[model samples]
Target: MASNEVVVDGEVVHCIGCGAAVQTIDKNMIGYTPESALKKGLENGEVYCQRCFRLRHYNEIAPVSLSDDDFLKLLTKIASTDSLIVYVVDIFDVNGSMIPGLHRFVGDNPVLLVGNKLDVLPASLKKNKVKDWLRQRANAAGIRPIDVELISAKTNFDIDRLLDQIEKYRKGKDVYVVGVTNVGKSTLINSIVRQSTGIKELITTSRFPGTTLDRIDIPLDDGKLLVDTPGIIQPEQMAHHLVGKELKLVTPQKTIKPKVYQLNPEQTLFFGGVARFDYNSGDKKHGFTVYAENNLYIHRTKLVNADAFYASHVGNLLTPPSEENKTNFPPLEMHEFKTTRKSDVVIEGLGWVTVPADVVVSGWAPKGVSVLIRPAMI
Candidate 1:
C-alpha cells in the first residue's frame, strides 16, 4: 500500500485515535500500525496508529521517536501556520529546557511562555518575579514571549489561569504547545483535558495530513486544533548521565526547603559527584543557601582538601555517579563566576546555590553539562 493511501477506506486520512497518519511499514516511524491492527481499526470504521491503539486498549504509551527531520517538519509547519505558541519550560532547569532557534521558527506567532514546576520553588518567591526571570531567560534565548506564566503542573496550580490565558491569546486560531522532554508538557495537557470536559481520556478524533511526527491534535470548539508537539530530547542535561533512582533523587517534587551554610573563602561544597561549588574569594563571611532536591547530599570541606577529597571520595562518599556509573560519567569541568549582585550558580539538571554580592565562586559539573550564573531567582 502507498504511504498516503488508506488501505481501509481508499481515502487518505490520519489516525482517528491520535491523528497520526497510518502506515503499515516501519514500526519505528510515526503513524505506523501493524497490518492486523489497521484491518481491525478499519473494520471498526476508524484507523488508529499502533501507538494510539496501545494507548486506547491497554492504557500504555508506546512512545515513538520524533526524528530530527520530523521535528524540523513540525517546526516548519508551525512557522507557516498561524497559531499561539505555548512554550513550556521547567523553572528548575529553565536554561536547559529552551528549544534552540525556536524564535526564528516562530514567524509571526505570538508566544506564551509557560514555566512548569513552579511548586518546586519556595513559596516565598513571588509569581511576578518568576515571570520576570522566565522572560529574561527567554529573551536571552532570542524569544520575546508576548506573555509569561508560572504554574505547577504537578499541583494543578494556575492551570485554569493558564488555560484562560491561552483561550484569550489564541483568538480563535490554533494553539501549538511545545517543550523539551521533562518539562511536564503532557501533564499540563492532561490537566487541561480534565478541566475542559471532564474527559480523562484524550482521544484525537480529528484528521490532518500525516505530518510524519506523532503530533497529538486536540480539536477545539472553534473548529481549530490545540497541537501537542512531541517533546525534544536535550543531551546537555546532567540527566543524560544519570539513571534509575539518581534521576528521581535529583529532581525536586515539591516546595524546596532552602539550606543555609555559613561560609568563608577557600571552602568547597560537593553536590554529590554530580556538581561542586567553591567559595574562592569574598570580602567577608556570607551565608549561601542551597536550592536543590532535599534528598541530594551536600558535603563541605576546605578547598585545599577538596581536590584530594574528591579524588578519593567521588562515586563513594560523593555519589550519583553512584559507583557503578562512575567510569562512564564525564570528568568534572570548572566554570568560575564572580557575583556583582546576588546570584545563583546553577548546575543544569541539578540545582543551584544562591550567594550574596561580591563573592567569587567556581561551579564544577560533568564536562558538557552546563554550569552558569544568573540573577538570584528567590
Candidate 2:
C-alpha cells in the first residue's frame, strides 16, 4: 500500500513506503519529498516520500540509503516472516549483485530468481544458455530458486510469464520482492502491476505480524500481499567507486555491442581504467569477445608495459577516472585465474570477457568490486 502512517520522535514523520524518515532536502538521499508533495499527501491523510510516490505512480526509481547493519536487520525480519522470496538480479552482474549468504536469510521461503535486463545482452547470446548459467551461479551462491525467469523490464518482455511464475510458486502465500539497487525492481513492479490479475491496494501498514519492520504492500486479488522491500546497496558495485558521469560509461544504457580481439600471451586489454585484463599466458593467438557497454573504451597493449601505460594514461588515454578523479580513484586490485575450459572473466558491474581454454588471465577492478570466472554462458 502507498502510505503507512508512522510517527517518529513523537513529531517526525516516516514514509509508509519503506519506513524511512522523510526529509525535504537532498534528493539523492532516502525519503526526500518536496514541500508541496508532502503537504498534499498530508491533506489527503497520506504521505509518500518522492521515491515511493514516483515508484507507485510513474514506475520510476530513486536512490535509498541504508547501512549494512540496518540491511541485515531487515533481512532478519524477512527470515522470520512467511513469504515467497522473489530474488531479482542483474543478468549482467549476477555474481556482484547477489546478497552474500542470502540462502540463510530467507529461512524456509522458496526463492524465484528473476534476471532482469536480458535485452542489454547481444541478440546472439542464447537465452536458454544464459538461463542455465544464471541457475548455476545462483546455486553457487547457495540459493536454489524454484525457477529462473530472464526478462527485460525496459521492453516488458516475459513480464506476464514472470507474474505467472510468481503465482505458481507463491502457493497463495505473500510475495516479497527483493534485490540490490539498479537491478530494475521498480520496472518489474510496474510490469507486474500492469499484467497481474486481480490486484487490490493494501490499506494497512501495521508491522508485518511479528516484527516492527514495515513494508509497502500491494494486495493481490487472492488476498495475498506482494511486498516491495527497500533495495540494499552493495558497496562492492563499481558505481560506488566512480563519479556519476563515469558511472554512465560502465552502466549498460543500451544494448551492448560485442567487440572481439585476437590476443597473444603477454597482451592486455584495459576496460577504460575501470578494469584490466592481462593475458599472462596462452599459446598461439586466441579470440577474446568482449561484452561491455558500447561506449566503454577497450585498449590493448603489451602486458610488460601495462603498468607504465596505466600510470601515464589512466585518466586520458584510459578514462572513467576522468581527468579530475585520477588522483583520488581507488586503486584497482588484481585477481588472477587460470581457465582449464572456455570461460568468461566477469568483472562484476563492468561486463565480461570471454576467453579461450588453457589461458591464464588476471582481472583487476576497484578494490572492493569483485572479479571472478564463470563457465561460459554463450
Candidate 3:
C-alpha cells in the first residue's frame, strides 16, 4: 500500500500524513500537504497521488514560500498597481493583523479594511464600537481606508456587502485582497469564489502563513479580476509557533461568550495551562471577562503554582504548539493596563479580557502574544 494515495478529480490527494481527517489546510496533520507535487508526477506520464497533484497543478505557484526579497517584489506589484486593496483583519487580533507600513505598500491605492471573524464575538457587544476600533487600528497602521466593513470569513457574513463595496470602490478595475496569514483570507476568498463563480473545488488553503505565496486571479463581472494575494506572517504571532492540532484548539469556531470573572488583587487566571494573567494591582477587585475558545481551559490559580503548572502540564494540559510544535513556547510576559475607557485587553488570537470601568489591572501571556486595549466588543 505504498502508493495508497490517489488522484481525485483534478487534484492529487493523500491520506493526511498526520492521521487527522484530510483537511487541505491542516498543515500539522495528514491530508493538508500540497497537491502540486502530485500533479507534476501525473504530467510526467506517471500515476501520481491526489495531494501531489494539488501541490502541482492547482497550486502551480509551488509551495507558498518566498524569500523576503521575493515577498517585497510581489508586494511591489500591488503597490504600483491601481487596483482596490481589500485588507482583511481578524477582529479578535486587530493588533497582530496590522501591517505597520501598509499605506506605503499600497501607495495611493484606496484601501478597504475588512474586519473578519466577527461571528466569534459575543452577541451583546456593540458593532459601532468594533467598527470605530477597526478604523483607529487602520489609522495607526498608516492606511486611511475609505470604509471599514466587518465580516465573518467562516460564516460568509457580510461578504456580499464586501463584494459590493469592492465593486463600488473598484470602479470596474481589479480588486486585490491582502492580509497577513491566518486571518482567514483563503477561506474568505473561497467563499467569494463559490458565491460568485460557483467553483467549489478546493484551492490553496493552509493554517500556516505563506499558503498563497503567489497572486491568484479570479475573474469578476466587467472583466475585472478579484486577486488573492499572500498574507505575510509576522514573527511575533502565537499562531506561527503552534502545531496544526494545537492551533485548531486555539482558533475560534463558534460565537464567543465573554467569561466575566470577579477577582480580588493578586489572584491569577490561567488560560488552559499555556498562559497566565496575574492581577497584580487593581481597584474595586478587578472584574475581568475573558473571551477565548470554549475548549481552552481558563483556571483561577495561585500565582505561585503558575510556573510549575505550566511546566508540568504544557503539551499535556495547557497544550497548543501541541507535541509537534518545533519552536519552544516563549516565557510569559506581563503587561499592565489602566483603563480610562471601558476596554478589552486582547491576547491576540487567544481571546480578550473585558475590563470594567475604573479597574486597573495587569495581564500576562506568552511572550509574543500581543496584549492590546480596545473599546469593549461585549
Candidate 4:
C-alpha cells in the first residue's frame, strides 16, 4: 500500500504503521490513532497493529505521545509510590536520551542509570569514561543515581550485573524503567526478563518513540515488579524529525569506528546528509574521525564553500531527509569545543567525533541537534 501525503510544517511525514504515506487529516485512517485505548472487540478490520491494540486495551492509553512534560507527569504519578527508578539512557545518544528535570520528580527514590547501546560504540572506548559521562549527564539532569552501569539491550552485555544492581537498589521495591523515546527501554527489559527468568513472552519494542504508552509489570523473586513505562518522544530530538526508515539507517547496528580524518584549518566534513563540520580555527591541520553510519557520506570542502555547498547539496549529496529536507531542514550552528580530557563530541542522534587529549576543535550540525563533550568511551 502507498501512503497519502499529509503536510506537516509543509513537509510529508509517514504513517508509523503500514508504511503508507500519510497526511495529518482524517483521523479515520493512517496517522490518527487515539492517544489512549479504544474498546476491545470493536468490529473493525485490523486497522492498527497488535502493539497499538495492546496499548489501547491493556494500558487504556494510546501512547503515540507528545513531549517530555506529558512523560514527566506520568512519571510523577509513578513516583508517588515508593518505586525504584531505572533511568534508561542510550549510550550512543546520551545527551538526547536525558529527560530534563527528571530528578525533581524522583525525590527520595533510588535511581539507577542504565546506559543502553554500549554495543553501538567502538569497543576500544573506555568504560570508565562512559560511566563518568552517564554520571555527569545525570548530575546535569539533576538526577543523582545510586548506581550507573552500561549495558547493551540488544546484545545482553553486562545485563546480569545490571540486574544485580537493580535487585540491590530496588530492595524489594517496584522498579520503574523510564526514558524518552528510542532509548531502548523495552529492549533492556526484554533482555532482563530473558536473562533472569528465561521467559520470552512478547513485550513492546519499536524503532520509533512512545511505544509503551502504559506500564506493564514483570514479577521478580524479591516481591518487586520491573515495570516498563512508555518512552516519551522529545520534540527537539533528530529522531522525532526523521522518517521511520531513515531512523533505522541512522540507528547503530554494531560497534562504531572512530573514523578520523586529518583536515587543515578551514576544511569541511559532511556527515551523511544529516550534518556538516568545518575546522574553523584550529592548528594548521587537525586529525578527527567521525563515528556515524558507515553508509553516510562525508565530503570535505573549503570553509568558504561549505555553507553554499550544504545549502545546494544537503539531501542531494549529504542526505537523510533523502530529497525532502533540502531547504526545509533547520539552520546549522557551529559549536566550539576544547577538549582537555579525551572525549567524544556528540551530536546527539547524529554521530560523534572522537577527540584525543588536549585537542581543541569546533563542530557543527543542524540547529536543535545537540553537540556536547563527554569522556571518550573509545
Error of 2 at 147 (Å): 1.3
Off by over 4 Å in 3: 1-65, 283-286, 323-327
**Candidate 2 Cα errors over 4 Å, as ranges:** 1-34, 42-65, 196-214
lDDT of each: 0.79, 0.78, 0.70, 0.70
lDDT string, candidate 1, 183-277, tens digits: 77766786787788786645431111112245777788889998877666667767767765667667886688999999889999998888899
By lDDT, the candidates rank as 1, 2, 3, 4
Candidate 4 lDDT for residue 138 = 81
Error of 2 at 257 (Å): 1.7
Looking at model 3, report the run of 10 residues with the lowest lDDT sum. Answer: 14-23
Give the lowest summed-lDDT range of ten residues in model 2: 203-212
Estimated TM-score per prediction? 0.83, 0.83, 0.81, 0.79
Question: Global CA lDDT of candidate 1, please?
Answer: 0.79
Q: Which residue pairs clash within candidate 2?
A: 1-217
After superposition on all C-alphas, the RMSD of every candidate to the true structure, in Å, is 4.8, 5.9, 7.1, 8.6
**Positional deviation of 211 in candidate 3, in angstroms?**
1.3
User: Which is better, 2 or 3, measured by lDDT?
Assistant: 2
User: For model 2, what is the C-alpha lDDT against the true structure?
Assistant: 0.78
lDDT of 4: 0.70
